[model samples]
Target chain A: MSDLVSRHVGPIVLDGGIGGGAMESQIRFTGTAVPLRIEIDFPHRMNESVVQDIDTAIDSTDYTDRLARQTIAAGVHRTGTCAAKPYASWTAARGERPADPTEFAGALTLRRMIIFPDGGRNNPERVAMIYSLPDTSDEHPIEVRFLQPSGPELCPVNVRPRV
Target chain B: MSDYDDLGGLVARMKKAAIDCYMAEDGFNPHWNDNQKYAKWGWAYHHYARPDANGEGGGSPLTATTTLEAQGSVAPRFDEIRSTIDTILTGWDTLPSGALCRAPQSSANAATALLGGAASVATVNDSDEIVRATETAMASLNDLAGSFVGPVYDKYCAQLLTVTQNLGTVYTILEAQYAAQQAMWPAAREDVVAICTSAAAAWEGRAAEIAAGARQDSFTVVAAVAGAVATVATAGVGTAATVGAVGAFASTTVSTLSSLDASGGHVSGDTYAEILASLVGALGALNETIAAQELELNRWLDETLNAMSTQLADYNLDAFTLADFSAGDGSSSINRTDTDMITTAMGRVEGALSEALRAAGAPPVSNPTPRPHAIGVGLAGTHLAASGVYDYANQCLQSTAAEYTRGRGLFDAAVADYFNTDAESQLKVTTLLSQEALIAEMGGRG
Candidate 1:
């Protein structure tokens, strides 16, 4: 079984996440406007059974619907998938290969994505993402996490001062 | 021969009468050249209707035989001859006054000398003499004419041909009134002196008409000659032919003036002075016209020659030495230094040649298009390429030759103008000096 871990992808705002999780933060917008690219990496070498199951789960309509809803909820909209690598020896086993299949060292599927902090999904203010595998073997299986906004801060002292 | 045979024959007989009357000195010979001695007398016989020749004709009847019938037979003939001469010379009676002759001659001589001196010193010749001479002559006439007081003074005013007829009428009225007054006061010496003064003034005033008439005649001759020059230039006559024409015209003027001098009826002092003035004015006018034309021709020549010199300097052919081909290594590539030298030299040659074309009034040669230096090939190949490159210089030379051919006509015209004008000026001055000498001799005799 792969160990799943949450990572901070961009900037951290303590109370500025969707659903306000303490450790979760939204990606900071920087530079020129562009589509964000979200990449998901799968294990390079796994058991035949595990690989079959993961492929089946990714192909399921219900699972795709769930992933899309989660991204929308996080204030990010998925635009399109990035182009696959050229047909070469290294990229031959990436994506789906059912007959006489071979698995890549680590396969990354890139998704074109965007973030709109001001609510209207039609216009996105920030769009960018970068993903890398952890150097340590124990840091395998990166997981995508959701952020929530904390509503407001309250202060106990309410005495009015003279102008 | 019948007296009415021909006008020429009649004129010859009249001329003989004039010579017999005025110029028949002890050993006077009647050659074509000697005819000048009787020119004034002939002029008087032809031009003046008055038979007395202004007291110059020795004795009336002018016949060798003094028989009454003989004198009577010749008197009518002599009168007829005088009338004919008058009709030819002035178409009226009465000669212009002695002062008229003196003023124009003196002024014109002074002006001619001034002009000749100015022309000799002038770097760029032009005509300033005509205006100066005209002013001087007119002023002199005015001064002489102003001193008269009576009817004779009115005659002087009348002779200023430019004066209105109405002025003459007014003067006539004044003269009549003066005469009536003199009759009433018979012993008025002041009135007699005034009349004498007026008569002298009238005589002096005629100088203005003489000067004006002479000036007009001179201008007409100059205009005619200039027209002829322009016609000859247009016709593309060779320089020699044009020069010949100018010489011929000048000779004709000299001959005409010599004859006028020979017709010896001029009254010695003032009349001779007027004739001298008229000749001087004519000569001054001719000199000014020719000098102006010569200056213009010289300007063209100077401009073209200067341009040629500048262009030759620009070419600086001395700097165009061929590069040292002897040191070439047995390699296929050309030396960069040699190529550069040839290229620079060729450029200069092309530029100089273009300037030469322009000086000749030819179309400018188009600049050769620049080509990138060819990679060093061995000496033989490099030489071949250079030869090709130099083709542009050769083309420039050809173009220059064509242009020079086209420019030849202008060059010839300038040459013709220079020589012809120079000749005309010399002729005018020479003729004028001769006439002045003659007038001086006549004045001395008087």
Candidate 2:
């Protein structure tokens, strides 16, 4: 993130955990009258709770790798799941077909979630919930992106143009 | 409201005129170049003007010329000419009583040596009445050399007085306008200060809520600014107090802002919103007051210059009109007589003196010889001095007009400078206070 974005947007925080407690991250930006704070919850999932599939799409990298690999414009790039990490990895049983359907590290699933505080536009207690689709193919992945829904972002890019 | 009022220009002009007159007394003095010749000629003319018995010389030959004409002693034309010369000389020498005159020391010395000395120095006119009167006029032209300013001042007195009054009026108008602005400033400033103080207090009331992380919103950013301002007010002694203030304000403002529905809008009903409206009103009024003051000052300057320009034009016309000194126009002198009259008188005076010398068996002379025959010399010398007076008068008038015109130009330049300076000042004040500028600075209405 650029200095300007860091000043207005929170740093991305991700936690690696089992299916027990839900980890949360916040992305807040200035809005008219009051600031709108966004809280995202990532629920942990146990390996046994995950459903078995013959063709499960998965990623083998850690959360940092996921973040780094994503195309993000340095300054005001508000895209990507700010908090995403490996939830569970899966491997197929001994080969009974073309291959065992597994590599050194097997299929992995990353979960993203959000909970809004209120429904009012100017309410300070407003919370939001966001969830990206879990079924992503090997060629494509989904990320939860934060948006400044209050209005246009009052960042340096928007404000410094005034004479 | 005012402009440069330097008295240096006026003082310098007066000083220049005084110096020119002083120099003229020396440079154009009839006897400055030829003292002895003038002394001799003045002696004869004075004697002729008043040839009395007892040899004190009180009787005038000009008075007797009419009698001489009736008796066929002189021609009628000569009598008329002599009368004309007498009239012109009477006007030329008409100075105020007790006026200083040139001392006739040179003529007196010459006369004393000629009449009251050795046989070689004695002349045939030793007891003649003509010789005695010659001594009188020569002692009186010292006053003539000193009379230039007096007549010139008298001639232009009315115009100069008008110019002076107009200058005074210009200053008076400036003072009045300045006083009016001064009177308006204190009240206007008080009103603005009062509004600012109230707005500050209202902002302070919300500072605790903002610092306590109550209504965390975009306004929290503004509250954080207020906290920082407070820290600055305490000169860094309140740093700890400012830390939480910045934290809560920044966190709450950003967090609250991120939840706003992209499709919706909200009108703030917060204390800060009211403060913005109040401040905008106060600043707009202040801007209007400043603009009004500028307009008032410029109006007064324009009016004063208009009146001054009109008067200056009239003064210039008078100065130019009176500059012509010719026989064809009667403005040849302040007394208003044709210049031809003075020349005519000069001719007659010379003619009479020449005939008198001839009748006395004195041969006509080329250069004046101190002999009684050289009475014709004084007229040219006296006329030369009079011409200097006219030239000096014309110069003074033209200079007065030029100076007045220069003063107007300076007044105009001063007004222009005042407008430029005031305009820049007003722009800064108005721009800083304008609602549009404030809105832009505060990240727009949102």
lDDT of 1 by residue, B1-446 (tens): 42222324333433344433322111111211233222111211111122232312222322122222232333354455345444432201111111222222222222222222223221213233322333332333333211111111121112111111111121122122122222211111222222222222322233222222221111232223233223222221222223223223224322332222211111212332232233233223322332222232233223323432343211122111122222122122223343333233323333433443232221112211111222111112112222222232223233333322222222223223333554433333334334323322111100
Task: Give RMSD to native, each candidate.
Answer: 54.7, 46.6
Winning model by TM-score: 2
Error of 2 at A142 (Å): 12
The DockQ assigned to candidate 2 is 0.00
Tens-digit lDDT string for candidate 2 (B141-171): 1222211212222223333334322322332
Could you list the iRMS of every candidate? Answer: 67.2, 53.7
Model 2 TM-score on a 0 to 1 scale: 0.21
lDDT string for model 1 (A74-94, tens) is: 321112211111113233433
After superposition, which runs of candidate 2 have C-alpha atoms over 4 Å from their true positions? A1-88, A91-114, A117-163, B1-152, B155-283, B302-446
